[model samples]
Target: MKSGYNVAVVGATGNAGMVTLRILSEREFPLRDIVAIASTRTLGRVVSCGNRALKTQKISDINWSDIDLAFFCAGEGVSSKNAEIVADRGCIVIDKSSYFRQHPKVPLIIPEINLDTLEKGASYGIVSTPNCVVTPLVMTLKALSEVASLKRVVVSTYQSVSGAGRRAIDELYNQSKEIMTTRSSRPEVFSKQIAFNILPQVGNFYESGISEEEEKITCETRKILMADVKIAVTCVRVPVFIGHSMSVACEFSKALPTKNIRNIFEKIEGVIVIDRRGEESGYVATPIDVQGEDAVFVSRIRKDTSVKNGLLYWIACDNLRKGAALNSVQIAESMIKIDPSLSKFRKTYSRTKEA
Candidate 1:
C-alpha cells in the first residue's frame, strides 16, 4: 500500500546504514518512502539511496508510527538507547547492533541461512542481525550442518577496518600513508597501529580469554543455527579496508568429503565456491578480492586430518555489506515475504514523534 511502508535508516551517514539504503533501492523493495536518520549533529546532511539523495533526520525526530521498518545501523550505544523504543512503536526494527540480539523476543537472523525463523512465532517488533564474523561464518556452517551434524568448529578471522566504523577506515588509511611518507603514525582507533600489521584481538577479552567478537560469533552462530554445537572463534582485525576473511575447520558427525562440500555450497544461493587446486590456480579469496561483493567466497577446501570427519575451508565477504547492512535489508525483505502486513504502516501506534 502506498499509504505507507515508510522506512527509516538510522545512522544513515555511517558505513552500514548507507549501504542499507543503497540495497533497498537497488533491489527496488516495494516501499512507499525512505528516510535517512543520523545523530542530531548530522541531521539534514544528504545521503544516497541508489541514485536518489535523502536528507538525514535525527532518530528522535522521526514519527515511529509512520515507519513500517527501521534499520538500526548505528553502533550498540545508539541501538541500546533507541531500538526498542522505535520497535515498540509498531515499526519492525531490523537492528544491526548486538544490543537486542540475545533478547528472547528478538530473532537473530541471517536471511539466507535462517529466513524460516520468521515463520516460527511472534516477535517484539524487533529482529536482530548477527555479528559480522558470524554472518559469513555461519552461512557456511549452516550449509554444512545440513549435510552432517556439526560437532565442533574452529575459525580464525581476518576482519576489516570498516567493521569498526568509518573512523577506523580513516585511521587505517592515514596510518598507512604516514608510515610510508613520514615513517611514523600514532595508533588512535586501534590499540596498536593498524597500518602494516594485524591485531589478534578484535575487542576486549573476557575473563575466559575469549575476545568480544569471538563471544558474539560463538553465541550468534549457535543462536542462528539453532544448534548446541561448539564454536571456537579467533577474531583478528586485519589491515584490510572492506572485506572480512576467515580460515575455518569443522568436525562433523559423518565423513563429508571435499567434493560433496563443493557441491553443497554450489547449490546454495548467495554462496560461491572457488576451490580448485592445480598447476594453474589462483583459487583463494583474500580481503581485497571480496570488497563490495555480496556473495560469500569460499576457497581452500580440504580435509582436516587431525579430527575424524573434519573439513577445512577459507571464506571471504565484504564485511560491511553481507556482514551487516545487506543482511539487515534482507531480513526486512524476508519478513515481508513471511508476513505481508509487516511491510505497511500500522495505525495502532501513536503518530507523534518518539517521546
Candidate 2:
C-alpha cells in the first residue's frame, strides 16, 4: 500500500469505462495518477473525468506494472485476456465482466452483499462484478433472505439497450427515427428491432428455453445469497436507454410481515423504498427516475396472495453505475476500508487531524 495509488481504467472509452472514471473522480478516490486505456480504435480519444479530460491510451500501451489498481470495464473477451496479466503484474483488478465470475477462485462481488468475500480472497488479486441484471436483483433479495430464509426466487428483467453497449444505444435511436419517418426499421445490434419493441429474449436461448441472461441471474443470485434457493429468470430487452428494471417474486420458508419487509429494505444501506400505494397517484419507481442514481429504487412491494410465504416487488437501478462502475469503485473503496495497508494516507491523516 502506498500513500496514493496509480490507477488505470480499462475500456476507458466505453460507457461503463467512462462511468468508472467519472465515479473515481466524483468520489475523489485517493490516487497519485489516473490513466485511461482502451482499444486501438479508441486510443487518443479524451474521456471526461469530473473536471479533467483523460486522454485514452491503447490497452497494449499500458504499463500494468505502474498501476496499483485497475478497473476493467472492457467486455468479457478483453477482460479474460488481460485480467490475469494485470494481476500478475501486482496490480489489483476489479473486473466488470462475466468471464471470471463463475470461476471457483474469482470472487463475484456486490459490495453490499459479499464484500467479505473480497477480503478473504485478496490473495487471488482479482475480483469480479456481476452482470447488470444480477446486481439489483441480488441486492433486494439479500435483505429479504436475511429476515426470512429464502426458498425460491423468480425474476423477469426489463433491460435497456445500453446494457448491450454504445452501438446498441445508437441503433435503438436510429431505428426509432427510421420507424417514425418511414414506418420501417432494420435490426443489427439486436436480433430484432429494439425501437418501440420489447424483446422477450435477452440472450441466446438453450434447448431448455433458458437464456444466457436468465442463467446468469439464477446462478449469480444463488452465489451472492450463499443459499441454495431455487431461482427462475426471464430476461427481456426493453426500449429504455439506461436503467434496468426487474419484477421479482420470492418464496420464503415462513411468511414475512409486509411491514417488516418494508422495514428491512428501508434499513438496507443502498436501497430506497418508494412505496406510495395509498396515495392519489400511488406512484412507483420507474427507469426514468433511476437512470443516473446509485440507489436501488424498490416499489410496489406486497405479499403475494397466491403463495403461502411469498413477496413481490419491482426494482430499478442505473445499470452502468451501481450495476458496473460504481460497484467496481465501491469494491476498491471497500478494499481500502478492510485492508488499511491499501490506503497510505487515509489512516495517518485521520489520526493526525484528530490529534
Candidate 3:
C-alpha cells in the first residue's frame, strides 16, 4: 500500500536488538525510515543498520502514528508492557520475548514453518517468535510430521553463554582469561563459572521439576504445531560463545526412513542438513562453526534403534539470530508478503479503535 514501511527496533544496543538491526539492513527490508529504541539509560548510544548509525531513543519518544512496524527484543518485562501498547496504536509488533509466545491472540511463528498463519491476521497487531531451541526444533519436527505423526520428542540442549545475553558473554570471556592466567574471577552473570565448565540448568526449575527453558521449548513447539505431542527436554548452558546446539530424538507413529530425512530438511527454507557420512561424519554441525550464521544447520541424522519409528539428530544455530532477531525479521517479511501495508494487523487495530 505504500512505497516502504517505517520500522523501529526496540532494545537496539543489546545482542538480539543489534542482530535484528543488522538483519533488517542485510535483508534490505523496505523501510521509509528506521529508528533505534532502547531504555532512557542508552539514549546517546548509537547502533548500525547497513551503513547508517542510529542513536537510541526511549519508546516514549517515538511517534507511534508514523511507525508501521516494530521489533521488540528487550525482554519479557519490556515486551509485556510495550509491545501490545505499540501494536494497539497500529504498528505491527514482532516480539522476541517469552511474554507473548503462548498468548492466545498472538501467533508464535517460525516463518518457514508457519508463515501461513499470517494469512489469518495478527490479532492485537502482534506476532511472537519462538525460543532459539523451539525455532529449529519445530522446523525439523514440522517437516517430519508431514510424513509421520509426531508422538514424542526428547531434546538435550547445549546452549551457549550468548543465549543468556551480552553480560553472560562477558562472564565467559573474563572467566576464561582468568583461568588461563592462573587467576580467579567470580561468576557474575551466571550462577557458576562458565569457562571450561558446563551447567546442566539453562533456566530456573519449576515445582514440577521441568526447567523454564525446557517447558518453553516444548510448550512453544506444541503451540506452533497445534498438537499435543509428548516432549521431554533438558536445557544446559554450555561455555560456547555464540551458537546453541541440541541433540534431539524423535518418535513418530509412522515409520520414517533416514534417507528421507535429509530431503525433508533440505526443503525447509532456513535449514541445512549436513549429515554426510564417511570422511564427514566427524565434522557434523557444531556451535563454534555456526556462530553468526543464520541457517539452522542439522547433522548426525540417524535412526534410533531403541524406539519404534524414532529418529535422532543434532542441530546448531545462532541463537541471537534465528532464535531471536532473524525470527522477528522473518515474521515481518512474512507480514509484508501477506500485505505490504501489514493491513492484516493495521486494519484489525484500526477497526477496533473505530468501534
Candidate 4:
C-alpha cells in the first residue's frame, strides 16, 4: 500500500456519508482517488468534494480490491455483509455501525482517547467507530479522567433528528408544517409526536429496561476509556434537525475546583470550552449553535454541591460530522501517517477477541 491511497466513502447519499466527504475535503487528507458509493438508485447523484464533483456508484458493483481503505457509513447490515469483503482485499475497513464494535477482533475507536486500540485491531481485518453519543461524552471525559478519577457518570441526550437519517429530518419538517397549518400530522418516522414533544426512548426497549441507544453509551464508554467507570444514560429524541447534545453529571475520586476543571478542559484537544462567569454568564451550546462545527462545545460547568467530588456540564457536537464521519476520517488519517507496515504488524499480533 502507498502513502497516498484510493479511498471509498460508502453510503455517500446518506447524511453521515455526505458529512464524511465534507470532513475529508476540509482536512485535505491525502488520497490517490475518491469514490462516492451508494445504492443502485443513487448511482447517478453528484456530491461535491472540494471543487471536484464525484458521481455516486453502486456499492455492489464497485471493485473493492482497488480500494486501500473503505469507510462504512451505511446501516449495520450493509456493514456486516460487505466490510469483510473490503478487508479481505487488503483494505482497512473503518466501520461506523454497532455491528463490529463489540467484537473482540474489532476496536471501537474515539481517536482522542484510545487510538492505541487501533494498533491492536489491524490484525483482525477491521476497525470500528463508536456511536455518536459515545464520541462526545468519551472525548470530554478523557480529559476529565486525567485530572481526577471518574467514578460514575449520568447522561441525558437531547438528540437531533438527523441522527435518525435524512428521512427523519423531512418527517420533523413536515410534521411542524402541518401543526402550523392547524391540520392533523401523522407520525410516520417515530412512535409518537416528535414535532413539539420529546420522547424518552431513542431506540427500542430491552428486557433490561434500558434502550439500545443508552446501552451503546455504557458499553462503548467502558471499552474506549478502558475503565470500570459506571454510566447511566437516558437517550431522548428531540425536534432539533441537526447535532446531538448531552447533559452530564459526573462524580470523581477527589474534589476539584470548578476553575481548575475549566482550565483543564480549555487545554484538551478536540474540545472547545465556552464557559463564562456569573449567573447569566454561564455557557450553553445548543444544537443549532453547534451545527457544522468540528469541536465539541462544553459549557454550563458547575460543581455539584451535594457530592464531595462531583461536577456537571453540557456537551454538544454535530452528530453526523464529529460523532461519526470526522472521527472515522481521523482514524484513517492516523493509519496513513504511521508506517503502513505498522498497521499490518499491529493487526498481525494485536488482540482481536475480548475475554
Which candidate's TM-score is highest? 3
Residues 1-355 of candidate 4: C-alpha lDDT, one tens digit per residue: 4557788999888899999988888999887798998888877899987877999988877787778788898889899889887787667788988999888778887777887776653376688999999999988898889888998899999999999888899999999999989777988888898998999989889999999899888999998888879899999999999999999999999877666878877887899987665657554788888999989999988888778788999999999988999999988877766655434623343234442
lDDT tens per residue, model 2, 154-249: 888899999988889899999989999998987988999899999998878999988888888888877888877888888899999999999998
Provide the lowest-lDDT 10-residue window in model 1: 345-354
Report how far off residue 286 is in candidate 2 (Å). 0.4
Candidate 4 runs further than 4 Å off: 1-3, 279-283, 340-355
Q: Which stretch of 10 consecutive residues in model 4 shows the poorest summed lDDT?
A: 345-354
lDDT, residue 209, model 2: 88
Give the whole-model CA lDDT for all candidates, comma-separated: 0.84, 0.85, 0.86, 0.85
How well does model 4 score by local distance difference test? Answer: 0.85
- Highest-scoring model, lDDT: 3
| Local lDDT at 2 for model 1 | 57
Clash pairs for candidate 3: none
Instruction: Tell me how many clashing residue pairs each candidate has.
Output: 0, 0, 0, 4
lDDT of 3 at 179: 92
What's the residue-level lDDT of 304 in candidate 3? 93
- As for lDDT, the candidate ahead, 1 or 2, is 2
Model 1: per-residue Cα lDDT over 1-355, one tens digit each: 2554688989899999888888888888876888999988887999988877899987778889878888898889998898778866788888899998887657788877777766565456778888988888888888888988999999999989999998999999999999999999999889999999999989898999988888888888888888888888888998988999999999999898656778887877899987768748567888888888899899988889999898989999998889998888888777777667873322233325334
